[model samples]
Target: MLQSYNFALSVVLLNVIGPSLSNCSVNMALGMWQKLQIFLAFVQSCSNPFDIVCPHKSHVQFRTQVHCNSTRPQYMCLYDENKKQYTEVCVEEAETQREGYNTILRGGIDGVPCSTNNYQPFSHSSNTGGSCAIVKTSCNDEGQLLYDDGSSTTDRSCRCDYRVGYDYVTVPSNKCFCKPAIEDCSCYMKYCDVNQVLTQDYKCARVYKLTGIFDCPEVSGLGSKDIEKNKKMPSNATKTGIFFVQIDYYQNKDKTYHGILDLILGIAIGMIIASVVLLSTADILNVVRLKYSHNDVIHIVCNHVETVVLCSIELKCHLESTRHCKFIYWTKRINGDISTITSRTPGIHGSTVTYPSLTLDSPLIEDCGEYVCCAVYDYGRVCSPPIRLTVTGDVPSFSVDNELHNTDIGKPVSLFCKIYANPPCSNVVWKKYEDGQYTTIHSDSIDCSQTKYFTFTLNLDTFMESDSGYYFCYATNIVGTSKSKCITLSERKYAPTIEVDVDDNYCFNKINEDVSMPYTVSANPPCTSVVWKKKGDGTSTTIYSEKIASSPSKHITRSFKLVNLKEKQSGEYFCVATNEVGTTKSQSVLLYVAEAEDDDFSSDENRSTVTTLPHRRTRYHSCPSNWETDYYPIKRRSRLLS
Candidate 1:
């Protein structure tokens, strides 16, 4: 088959085929050798267990995937969900997949299966069309990963698994209830199970979930003795805490209770009839909030480059309140002790009990840990929820060369991903993106393989029209993945090449004699036409013309003879091969048509000796298909036409 570029996968096969094409002949055996080699390799790579393989979204640029494995050897593989099997697609086929067709699944992507707990089966777009994709999944704060076995297409879902000690409750359960597993248990039944036991008071008791953090102290009412003292002296009354749960009565009952209760009831009744107000407010307030400044994420991951993080501390208070207060920062290193970052009293920019922002700035590696916000007041101190600030590294940033690449078919080309990242990128790989989706260009190896040139590169030994498109590099670290700007690239195709079998050779014969010249060519897309030209006196003249038949193998050699050679027929002759890529001419050979006969050389100054090669075959009809051969050269002076 002709070396057609498939848009599905941008594969570079010429590095392997380009060198081999040089030795093959465009004769009857055309490209048999190269074809056989390609077929065998393709069969070996895609034989079994591999399903549908997708090609690069755009092939204006292409690259080869590292060999997969011995059994299912391929650049990338896809599992057919419905078929429940892996279908092998050889590396070549994977690179040159057809565009706008062929659905490529991402189950067995990057030459391997997606991470069980990390990646979920997803779909993406290709060439502006929808196709299968493999994406990563994440869980939220109140979620738990109950099960994950690494399914490429199935996303692991978070389950609700509530725990007692680890969880919290706003109100402690003073009373506990039981829901029996017995199907016949009555919903209205308030009795304990048969295995349950009652307390000393003949009451059933059970443990309840622990309260979240801490609870405020309960209020205690005044003692009976104190109430009696107050009642004895009607004018000596003082405020005392009261609680409804602590009411006491009988025997030494204080008559003051009756008087107070009657008075309170009278006031409550009058209030319901518009004697009192229904609104209340508290003035004491202390609120604290902490977060990183805009785009500052040293609080996320460590970075090799110099970095900074502004921990913005927000204190909520009333407006117009300017209470100068001390602002303190703290740092807790990983697996280390917490240390205070001393600070001076910040000139309060707003009113006390008002919202004001306090900021702490630093790039210290020790600034990675949980944080607490505290707002001190005359009455007390209030603290906010803890926040963990990690400074492991910053998200990576990089750039691409975006240089233009121009080349013809059967030629080699290379592209590089010149990028700069902080904390250095843990992994960098090429990817083809189209229609809001990206296709990985390499199989992640042990830590992922690195392409050479500028540290990361994509080399295409050879590609076709389909191998033209946009490509870019993707970098990743512990922080996250970063995408570089895409570059538009194209690999121009060219025509086949023609060359003379022997260089600087001349064919001489007397006028009216016949001369046979051999011309050899190596072409792709099979040269559609051939022409013979003789360059004489500053101009080129076509001496022979013929249409060449297309062939799978166009590396050919042909011999054409000029009968009854005339003086004008003598010149430099060369062969031209034309294909879709372009046209190329072979090396020129000198052709001399002389007026003197063989015997006229005996005339003194112009006389020359005639030497014959006894082992050599006769000339005039000698034409060999092979261009790469061992042929001795003869000097033009005193050399006979052979």
Candidate 2:
């Protein structure tokens, strides 16, 4: 009987919570303790009392990440299997007990306010879930009143604007509405129009009109009976939407000097009436506003900058009443002279007749000042806001335009030199040390920055093995010339050029006499291997061999010596230099050996003839235009070694 009773109890409890259960697939293998907890908290589904969800029944999962932000979050059970599900145990463990969940709005359908009531994001399914946590605003924002119903995904639209003569309904029912002042006056006495003011002692009171400037000119016929409000009336009538003012006037005449007084009075009255009519009908350019693009002072360095000076006539209806919509652009220079750039006539109501700006191309600091646009009407003229323009100047300083000055032989080289000379740069000089001489390099003007930054371009048709040297750039401005840095072009690889010097030889019978054949090698990698050879029987025999570099033999050439000379020493001899690129052989010189007694012959016969070879020079420079360096030409003269 007790088992039967427990079965009955379980059935009854399931029936009670069945409807509230979600379709979420339940994890069946739960411990008995968890089952007990579920039984205990069966009716308290998320923090919301209206939501009694059973995960097993819904066949979906839920995860709650709640932050009670400005949107006022309420705990909800969103049913979407695809989304991460908040476990029921976590919800129960959190503030759901008493304090409630401190979370943002949820996604997917739950028992929340707009969740299921106006759900339309997608069809409801166990696989789909999550809550719309997007921040939502109620119509009650800014004291606005709600006029129509809204859904959970949409915001409640406000009803009326209190600033435009409506007051808010403070009651809970009318929380979303701003209503007419008359209907809300009793409870909302604070709302008042600009013409009315709220009094500390009572409702809104009419502001009194002062004299002179405040005096209204009489309209000859319209509502002239009671020109001014009757102060005799009770205050209550004025409190309710009374929006008009009244005025009164009195006149008296004396016949003592009737004729003369009448003349003077008639003239004064005519003048006053005429002035009033003219002032009322005439169009004043109060709308002529100046438009300056920048709020701060403009600074320029020999650069092009334009200042905007626009005039806009906002009176569309009054435009037809004006004679012309002429505008004049004027400038106040640093010299204190106010010069007019030009004038435009009959400009369109909303736009300038032409581009309305003062373009100062390559201007000096002397051109710095103020600029303004003015609208000229028949009676008067009005100017727009003034704009401040400035031109700045500084000394010239050049910088390298190329990062690296390495080049391959026979390839074209383009070196660029650039400098910022606030006030135009006066001159630029390029110096190069190439081909054994210090010569000037001519640079072409790169017009791109000619009006702004000083830029020079030096272009070489082709780079040669000899075109490796230092270059320098000099730029001059008002202040002075700028110091330059050197740019050196290093040749990656080059074949060696070899030259040999010969000494006049005659077979000297002296025991210590020797004939020397000295050689020089010029190669980028500095020929590493050099061999001295003597041509014999259509073939050559190597006499000397060694590793040499960087023309180390520049100041001193290595030579093959033939000491203890004899007639048998006569032969054709030469030296060869080799690097990674290629090899070069020096000019072969004939070594003549003779007997000392045989000197009786002619000097030509007695002397061994010497031969010389001529070669061209090369140039290399680096700078802002890539024109930087002291490129002094290096003469390729081979010196004989001891």
Candidate 3:
């Protein structure tokens, strides 16, 4: 026979072929060793009963109680929620023998009855006392089972029991909301119930459920039972409320496998997109290179770029993405290809670019010409087409060196003129103004270097006051002409050579004596005039006058005579000479004249006269007179007189 109960509240086992069934007493006892082993395993797996159990009444009560005085024994109990209480069965209890009023319920889910057959006679109610009365009512709402009241008068009788079959006299009430009892009333609920096993729907009924995470168990068939002949069992066990709840094993396995596949697929898709983008960008760059040619930027315009700001034009290369490129060099092919690179940021295009714009520094006429620009990506030297830039006006440039000063009087002056030209000047001329005529001292054509720069010298040895104005060294070529700033020439001042001389008697004479002295003054550059002065008083009293000729080749000479000599007039004397260029003076000289000596006379001729004819004759004959003669004395006197 099959049996059924709630999985959480009661567990019914249909022993189809176990050898333990017997036909004697209502208690079916197990061997001591077997009983102890089952009890110990169950106790180890069960949670605390007090927290989980609830007590309630249900028809056909099945309960167990074990008390041992000789040994300390442990027992296992399970909660029966369908029966609304805890159910404990002793493993060592012996099974009952009579089959008078017993019916077994067999099925697998909650709320379904098991098959009832072969015990229909126990279903009749006789109101008589017999063993058949034990099957008086099926477990229903009226015949309720409860725990004993906690009092001395409380009923302790075991009204229901399970094993082979100790029948019950009353039906048990089944309720869902009863709380677990305290103290002796402690109970718990289980998963299965008796009605679920007896109903025919139990065989095919499906249990519906929903969960937080997806999982499903493998389906299996239910136990088969007949409801018509089944009678209620006396014992009531806990119902099997809702069991089989744990982690969602089935869904966890599927999610883990799905996640791994998604990651691999995502990586593959990313790699493919990156490769396509790189290839497309490379092809576009290649197409731009083939479109432009080198001969494009070599063009000529009539006038150079002039005006403060004219229309802005651009010189562009067709290459835009110059990520690997270096400088863009520009050259004027028509104008001898003078080259320069823009020191500014250029405009960028798709695969092309424009240079720093074709603008003027201050808009000059010299810039009106042709130009070219090239792009250098690396050491590889990539070149672009020449760009034709037409500046409107001519570029005027003044060539000059620093200002020159302190030149020698008779030396030549050479100033350098340097100019940078856009179209190459015609010629450079160095000139000076003389006699109101512009005389070109030096001239040269700039066609040699094409840059207007040359050296020129002006012979200024004969430079005079009239030549001391602004002298211009002008540069003029085919492109344009510019003059160096007017360099000023000034005449240098210099003193002339001066010579001075005094007459033979320059000393002062005695008072009232006629003393005469003469002096001369002279100079080169032909002294324009001359004058004399006395050193005692700086008064320039002119004693001589003369006019001189031109400098370096002419000179002048003048003389002055002083006719009066006096003690007071004896002092230093000097002369001054002047020329057209400057003046000069001589150093002073001092003069003094002494008085004449007085004569002394006596009565020497009154004494006597001695005659000597012989001495006289001898004196005529070129002989000396004798010593003994008075003629000798006379001769001596004559000698003294001669």
Q: Which candidate is the best by TM-score?
A: 2
Q: Choose 1 or 2, whichever is better by TM-score.
A: 2
The parts of candidate 1 lying over 4 Å away from their true place are: 1-395, 402-415, 420-424, 430-472, 482-497, 502-504, 509-515, 522-529, 535-540, 546-556, 563-572, 576-642
Ranking by TM-score: 2, 1, 3
Angstrom error of the Cα, residue 179, model 3: value is 71
1 against 3, candidate with superior lDDT: 1
For every model shown, what is its TM-score relative to the native structure? 0.28, 0.30, 0.28
Ranking by lDDT: 2, 1, 3
Model 1, 553-592: lDDT tens digits are: 6577766666555677666778788888788877778776
Q: What 10-residue stretch in candidate 1 is worst by lDDT?
A: 280-289
lDDT of 3 by residue, 1-642 (tens): 001211211222112111122322102222322342244335323522222121222211222223322242322243344564444322333223233332121221111111231122223221111122222222211112222221221222112211111222322232111212211222222122321111111121111111111121111121111221133343322221122211100112355544554464345335433443343444434434433322223222322333321334444344444254443444344334233334441331112234423433332344445554344431222334444455543444665565544343455554555555445555556677677887776443435344434354444545444455667866554445667777766644455665544333233334334322333433333566665566545454433444544445444443343333345545666667777677877766455533432211122342122223433321111011111211111123233223
* lDDT on C-alpha atoms for all candidate structures: 0.40, 0.41, 0.35
